[model samples]
Target: MSEFIDGVITEVPQQYSPAGELDHRVHADDHSNDWWRHAVVYEIYPRSFADSNGDGAGDLRGVRSRLAYLAHLGVDAIWFNPFFTSPLLDGGYDVIDYRDIDPVFGDMAEVEALIADCHSYGLKVIIDVVPNHSSWEHRWFKEALTTEPGSPAWARYHCVLGKGVNHELPPNNWRSVFGGNAWSPVKNADGTDSGYWYLHIFDSSQPDLNWDHPDVHKEFEDTLRFWFDRGVDGFRIDVSHGLVKAAGYPDYPQHADRAKRSAGGEIIDFEPLPHWDQDGVHEIYRAWRRVANEYEPMRAFVGEVWVDTAQRRAKYLQHDELHLAFNFGHVGAKWDALDLRERINEALLHDKAVGAPTTWVLENHDVPRVVTRFAGVELPKSSGDGDENESADDALRRLAVLTPEQRVVGTRRARAANIYMLSLPGSAYLYNGQELGLFEVVDLPPQFRQDPVWFRTEGKVVGRDGCRVPMPWRNEAPAYGFGPDGSTQSWLPQPSAWGALSVQEQQGRADSMLELIRTAVHARKSHEAFGETDFIWRDDIAEAIAPGRSDVLVSEHGGAGNRALVVLVIGTDPVDRPDSELLVASQPLTDAQIPGETCAWFSLS
Candidate 1:
């Protein structure tokens, strides 16, 4: 039998000769040059990026209009969130059709145009592909539900039979990333027990397909080929870990008593689930790698592995698996210099052993904005004393607390973080609006909340809607011109103070956060060390910071060179020293006596 291994063509010889004859040689050169290893990826949320049509939402045309802006940013690639035909469930993660573009986004032609335009501007386009599950409205899922259990279409999915049987029984103890039961009861149109249930790792609306099925594998392979045929550069796989599951779904062990509350009056159960890091996942990834190899230029597949441990995270990046797995440890770490250093060191060491690159991200549409998470200071409510309605004075008072110098310090800390992430030897992902120092919207009205977690978690999680607010494009236009019409309200409301943070205002102001981002990106592009470089952290400096104190992180980068590029990050809080060698500060570090917030690049020589 012939099998494709990691996109390489290999043939099994019927019999081995006494002299150890070779059957076939795999094409080692095909998968060797992966551009994502040293590229900077900029993530764009299609619905909020720009509006080409007068539909109040962003479309492909809108993205086309912004090609120059992205090219100007100096990122090598753009990872567009799914613009495929979807029911808008889970923010387009519930893909309805893998082949067609959503009507709201544009037609298939428009997508191709966007890709062509991006390529013309020297930018690579990577689309988000949700293979773990599909929208219940997907044609295949609909056919599976309607067709007989033994039919081909039925076999294409994980449809099982009998109430509480394979269908009714819980797949295992695995819990959905979103809170609640992972299984959804399947019923026939006649309202009787179908004698089986379906597994949805996330929402009931998203039915997880069984990858163990041979036909299912073939179907996805064809889908991958379809996109490759369409000239897509790569795929940012959603929930990359959920492609495979344990043989039998088992119950996850409860870490703490749900009936009891902790000192913070919060239910605390943060233990690891038994089946999260399953062994079967590797096989599925290897299979995807085989499919990716069939195409030229070797398409990239970056996975989102949400594990806290470095070893488990590194496992996803094993040579035959994904090109890069999200290094989420950095994203989840506290905003302390020392903590960041430890996480980066762990990632660098683990990836070096596996001979795989890492992907770094500070913010994403699915999480709270990094600025809000690390700003160190919280804003006061619109109402000064917690009242619903308040005068403009309350807003002014809140703004007053965040002085220009404080804002500069905060922005600088963020810039330092960016320098640390981009300078590392891996692909770096910059979330949309991150360049503009976008913060999470403080309060979202009930009607404005779109995240399912808000409903299941009872508002305790704050949901992801705050971070999904529309991008601010212009300062004077209504709603900052994020919507199709300048006067139209965006799908996701613009943050209250977004008018002041518009792209136009930032572009005009040299000192704006947008300019700072542009400078950093250009710096990364101009430096040869940033591309295909190796990181080497100073052991003495790393060891100096206290284990628990999250201040002052330091790292050095060198690859076959006598001199090294060093980066020093200072946290928002005050530093111990009055003066030091300021290599570069994201924003001006007043505490460090840094002249400006701009990143200062220097040669160790």
Candidate 2:
């Protein structure tokens, strides 16, 4: 059993003030003792995990059954995607109720059981909470639509009436993520129009709640308490920065006059209207923090801050906001050593600036799998050279010819990327199936496509469903062990060629991608570099390891006082030249190596 610390290292300072610095050290005594700083969170999409019953959908029981597997995987916490009562619009982002679990997944009792089971395995549970908006079918919205404009329910949402004289439209000009308008017209039950429209910011079925209302604030506070009381460890808040919008609802600079032409033309901007930022949103967060503090000391609250700049991202973590905010700059970055080093340096510096913990993720439900995104390798195409080239009938044979040596080299590069993410001084989130080296399955048929992004963009955007397919458990099992026992189909079909990457098959192979993940995770837990926050980049050495040199070297200076840990990752991919070891090898990785390959580890003595 792991020893429990009263408080884990939670905060990393931007600047060192030897004597008068803020007590950024996270100890058991601090109110916000965020344990997530050192956690390795594994994300699970309920629909794709294992299904307990034969209902063709995954459920809480399915998750409960997999506790042993997760616990054995060495993850500190599990971040479950939304399983709350929802219309399934936007994949459960449109919540109809905040307190109950969706019957399709299971009931509240089953969720409670899952929580209990996870705790039994020493695994903390962090569930997704969509605080920005709720389904149009939510009771509050139903009441707002039926009640008079002056009623309490009416004030709970952002509703504005159009003025004929002024030509007033939706409060502002912010665009919805899924495209189109951020406001939907509301009609009263009496057959007369309410004249006022509600703000959505996403799908029209999801109406954004007004934080300016005391009742709305109370509802969320209560909702959080409801889950906290049920023993939930924490929350991964969805669109956390979007809670409170500007009060007056002002117009933004027009990117274009029409929807098709504007940069963010589809939706309306509602945040800069009035005093949105200062309008009690922080107060609500502080209140939630107070309640969270009353429970387990290390309880965490992570927010999704989708801002572009590090400065703006730091604002969300300033004080009493979120314990950790998701950093996306790295995920969106192109695969370049210099670019990665700069991004990492920037993120670490930002964490110190905010005095709040930071979280890193390479892949998530909304993004493509990291293997497909970060692996700098391309499969050789069929050249029709009758002698060496093979046909579609020889696809599996072609796959066989693609040597394990090649797979190892490619996987090591990916593993090095994982090392870079985990070695940084913050919490790291591992999306489901990422550890298995899963690639994005773009072969999804049009009929089975569920992502709204695909429909809104007319397929211009590939959408995120390809990454949300069922997890493969066994090599030969139907639906890759995601469906009912012996069933061939699943809620979403498993990727056709995923059998070779199944967990069962990889578990037996010492050199499989799954083994690499296990090794990296295990090493992360065992290394102080993964847990400690003092990292000073060795600029001279870092620049020397940049591309065209065949290796990437990164050194971090810090340890008690004078000691330092230097990590060297050697690339063996085709892009990297052979015999290109510029610096004397400090520690050579025993794993496979190919041209342009990469391996990671630190030397600390």
Candidate 3:
């Protein structure tokens, strides 16, 4: 018999075992279909990016208006988060209609125009695809809500019979990633409790689909083709680790040390829980890849996979599977040179084994802004051990309760991190406000909060609203020029101090983060070295600059005659400058020393 302990099932009478082996074999393909390998992709959360209609919300047209700015920023691609038809719960992740655009975001016509505009400006468009779940208002979910058990509509989702005799309890002890029970009890028309329950790994409003059902697979494939037919360059898959759950809704294991590791501190990878990081998820991606390959130029797919280790994360990037998967190790690592170096090496090594390029990201719509995160606020010490789970929402939760932002310190560290990250091999993702040196707006009033996480947790967790605050484009304009003049207040309030951080204020300033990022991005494009997926640590140079010092990290890229070196000084003391043509520096090099907490790039002849 099973018993509930602290809202989790401790044991189950009948347990479902998962498959022991993973099918890691991938399709044989050449390097011709690889556009994202070294691409600089920018993630634009549509709602907070720019407001177009004076409706206090950003729309597709708003993104269309910003094409010139993005083109000038030198990003190869723009990854727009879902503007699909939705009720706006979970920030559009709970997609209601796969084919239609939400009225608030604009219509199908605008999306096509925006895609065309992006292409004209030499930008590839990658839209967010939320395949794990759909909004409750979705036709399938709504029908499942009223259908009888074992019905076809019910089969579309993971609707199962309850455990108890009276069918009062959830089928299993699985808990929602957001909070509360993963199972929501079904109800009759009169609102009486029905004997069936459905699984929702996320919010109750978002129901997890039954991948075992062929209908679910067919629908998503059709959805993919729908956008691909409309000229989307690729897809940024949301919750790519999800979608396939364990066959049986088994009870979640309860243990303080849930992660099993080897003596060397590497995660002894095993299939995670009944809900997450399952092996079956790979088969689905392989099929999706076949579909993507059908197109000319081949639409790419990048998964937002949060697994236990870099090795496990690499599984999603097998040749026949996703083209790229986001690497969170770099984001979750502490702001230490040694820690960052180890993580970078691990990711590069693992990704290289799969013949895939590492997809690096600093911050996103769901995490704390890098500026505030690296600021003086305390971060949990990382033991230089690999924990790939830190890239997910749970890790963000820990950051939600951080100390207030220290603007000067955070901005400096952020600028340095960008220079260092951009110099690394493989692709890099820049969040929308990252270039403006935006820090987390941690002090927004509680009443103004809109993140579903903030409400679901009943104010216990502060949530990601801090990073999702509307962008500040102009210092003096109302709502910082997020919307047109005389527009309604922004959906979320912006900090008053962002006036100095606005693009208008930083545009021409050589010392501004925006200019620095622009310079670094252009350098990455102009140089042939950054195009390759090979970089060697220049330990000899580091020793030459700061003899026997472990604080200075230098990497060399490109060929001998036209090589480039990226130097990062992480210690308190400055290092002697290298004898190379200066390309760009996070901070002004006032003298012959590279200041501590500064990163610089130099051209070597």
Best model number under TM-score: 3
Query: Which whole-number lDDT from 0 to 100 does residue 60 have in model 3?
Result: 88
Writing each residue's lDDT as its tens digit, candidate 2 over 435-496 gives 78876666676777787765765554546777888888777645777755766677667765
The all-Cα superposition gives candidate 2 an RMSD in Å to the true structure of 8.9
Give the 10-residue window scoring lowest on summed lDDT in candidate 1.
Answer: 4-13
Off by over 4 Å in 3: 1-33, 256-267, 379-405
- What's the CA error at residue 396 for candidate 1, in Å? 22
Cα lDDT listed for each candidate: 0.67, 0.66, 0.82
lDDT of 1: 0.67
TM-score of 2: 0.80
C-alpha TM-scores of all predictions: 0.81, 0.80, 0.90
Tens-place lDDT per residue, model 1, 124-180, is 988888888889998888987776555677655566543343455554555565666
- Best first by TM-score, ranked: 3, 1, 2
Error of 2 at 197 (Å): 1.7
**Local accuracy of candidate 3 as per-residue lDDT tens digits, 393-491:** 444444533443466777888999987888887889999999998877766788988777667767556678888988888886458889987775799
